[model samples]
Target chain A: MSVIAFAKNWNGKFKNSTFELVSYTKALANQLNTNMVVLSIGEVAEEELKLLGNYGADKVLTVSNPQLNTLTSRAYADIVAKAANSVEAEVIVLSDNNSGKAIAPRVSVKLKAGHVAAVQELPLSLDPFVVKKSVFSGKAFGHIQIKSDKKILTIAKNCFGLVANPCDVAIEEFALDIDTNLFKVKIIQEEEQKDKVILSDADIVVSAGRGMRSPENWTPVEELAEVLGAATACSRPVSDEGWRGHEEHVGQTGKVIAPNLYIAAGISGAIQHVAGISRSKCIVAINTDPEAPIFSVADYGIVGDVMDVLPRLTKALRNSKS
Target chain B: MKILVCISNVPDTTTKVKFKEGDSLFDDSGVQWIINPWDELALTRAMELKEDAGNSVNEICVIHVGGASADATLRKALAIGADKAVRIDACPADAYHVAGQIAEYLKENPFDIILSGIESSDYNGSSVGAMIAEFMDYPGISSVTSVNLDDDDIQINRAIPGGKQVLKTEAPFVAVVQKGIATEPRIPSMRGIMMARKKPLEVKPAVELEVLTESIKFELPQEKGACKMIDSESAEQLVELLKNEAKVL
Candidate 1:
């Protein structure tokens, strides 16, 4: 039996999340006394694939079908399921992102494997194959056990940091016939966000809410984010009022992020909002209300008006850097 | 055209999470149940489409895989504008099991369009929609923000990592929707609520399926310590703390 780790790429370049996944599955493979094989689909250069070996992949299996460039859930699942069956994989792992959420379940159905998503830790017990995951939108944790011999798990973002364990790695091509008929959904157009830090992958995030008062007063927030190289986020009300795009809403219903540092300005910490940012390594909250719920979870609290505080903070950071 | 919206009965968003049975199960005592927020939005969008005369949508049905207690949630869905309700009589064991039960039902009773939330607020698995699509061999779209029906073709807009993706597909598909699907969920009117009680709520036995995962225990996240207050005038001090004390900068 072997372990399979699905590696994802964007324009043939692997990101930090893919490296973290490979490192995580490598540790799991070691614990199980087995070899870990990294699987890549679509286009990725040989040297870029070899970088996965630095994180402990015993071998890399890749399928370079140009038709596979765009993700079709059914076709990707079919390829992953076939790869798992070929190696008689006991465990299959994928990142708990959009693609993984779409494809992992289908793979589980194909393999008849017990599946878990957003798993936060390695198995607690090998005998029962138990792992821990967040439930209730990170309000609590659940220890889940997979009963099937074949198991599929999607690792949560930023849960397991990257670790390098270089080793001799072999690359092999996995051949599969392209079946374009399964591509039922046809993409008509694509709009890619340019020259901005993706919220899910950002290490530091600077966010605000209605306390900024209006959308026009967002210059300070954007200036601070630009100075710190952080992504900007907003509360639900901010998005609901059309002050910011819905994509910038970070909360239980929106994006659940676990950045290294999260700075909230002028936002009253609602339970739903707190649920999303509670995983950040450090939280700094600034609000006029001393009793705001956000202060309770924050590592540092500042009681002041956001308009006054934001510019001051931005100036301070700029001065400190200069 | 027929539309099936999958609903999940979850605790209210403000409900404090607690577990009973030696931490093996969620403690439901005094916990008010409501339709999963995302599912409610999906149902709201379906209702909107059905209300538009230009669309061919005729029937709107809601389905849930749970025990009898979830019937109230289904009624709530009906009151919010579903034409009928279905309750597969069984406890939802896991995502795989729930998707399987729904897939089995659809095999015998197929709908033109199937809608589900991107993830349930409770378990937050984000799996059942695609799994159902796979099981039924239908196209599945995730992170869908807006779904429109132009004649018989379905146009969908979804949020990708950096930007948005626009796609087109036919009927007999699953669209897993998120926040922007509907601006707001509709509240049930007095007349609608009265009529919901008389609406058809068919209960069917669950098909046999293998249970894949089991929960062994549940625990709350660790409590954070008291916040270290920083003087508002001294903004630079906070930056120093971030660089020296927190080491995040």
Candidate 2:
């Protein structure tokens, strides 16, 4: 039996999340007394593929079919199932990102494997194969037991940090018959956002809320983010008011982020809003009302008008950096 | 073309979550129920599509796999302008079971378009839509922000890692929608509420399926320490604290 880790890459390069996934898979493999195999789809350089070795991957299987360039969930699931069957994999692991969320369920359906998404930690007991995950938008936790023999799981981002365990990795090319009928959805256009820190991957995030007063008063928030080399986010009200793009909204219905440091200004902490960022390691809240709900979960609190506090904080950070 | 929107009954967003029964069951004493936020947006977008004269969407139906307590939530969907509602009478055991029941129902009653939220606010599983699509062998598009019909063709825009991608697909597909599918969820009007009373809300028996996962325990996150308050006049001190004390800088 083996553990399969699905590694995702962009433009032929692995991201930090891929390293974390490999590390988690390696640890799980050790617990199961099995080897770990990392699966790579589409085109990635051989040199780039070898990097998985640094994270304790015993073997790397690359499927470089040009037809698999674009992400078709059905086709991807089929390929992953075939890889699992070839290696006799007992567990399949993936990151709980957009692609993983879309594909893991389909893979589970194909393999008849019991699946769990956004799993937080390793198995609490190997006998019953129980794992823990956040539920109710982070308000509560649920310990779920996978009853089926075959298991599929998607790890929440940032929950498991990267651990390097260098090994001699065997790289192999995996070839599978293509079914052209699976490619039903056609891509009409693609647009990539350029030159900004992606919020989900940022280490630090500076976010504002209605306390910034208006859309034009966003200069201080943006300046602070620029100085810190962090991403800019907003509360739902700010996005609903059209002060920021919907993508910048960080809350229950918006993007859920787990940055190392999260700074909130002028935003009253609503439960829904806090649910999204509750995973942040450290949170600093700046609000005029000292009794704001955000302060309860915050590590640090400053009571002041945001318009007055933001500029001063930005200046202080900028000066310290210089 | 008929459009089917899947909805889940969940606690209101503002309700404080608590579990009872030795942390094995959710306490529902004072909690208010509402349609899952993402599913509400999906239903709102469906109503918008049906309102347009150019589109062939003549009927919009909403479906839920839950017990009878969720009938009110289904009625709320009808009040929001869904023409029909279907409730598979059973406890939603898990994502797999819920998806299987819906897929079994769909085998006999098919629709051109099926829309489900990315995840239910309660479990946040984000699996049922794609699983349903897989069970039925239909194309499933996730993270969808917009769905439009242009002269009998469907166009969808979905959010990707750094940007967005636009795709085109035919009918008999599942689109797991998220925010931006509609600017705001529609509030039920007085007339709409009265009409919803007469709309068909069919209750069907759930198909037997094996439950794959079980929740053995529930836990609330540990309480955070009291916030370290800093004087407003000493804004620089906050930065120093972050650098030296918190060590996050």
Instruction: Indicate which candidate wins on DockQ.
Output: 1
lDDT of each: 0.93, 0.92
Task: State the lDDT of candidate 1 residue by residue for B1-249, as single tens digits.
Answer: 999999999999888888988988899999999999999999999999999999999999999999999988999999888999999999999999999999999999999999999999898888999999988988899999999998898899988888889999978999999989998889999999999999999999999999999888999999999899999999999999999999999
Clashing pairs in 2: none
Report lDDT (Cα) of residue A291, candidate 2: 86
Stretches off by above 4 angstroms in model 2 are: none
Model 1 lDDT at residue A139? 96
Show how many residue pairs clash in every candidate, following the order shown.
0, 0
Measured on C-alpha atoms, candidate 1 has an lDDT of 0.93
CA error at residue A114 for candidate 1, angstroms: 0.7
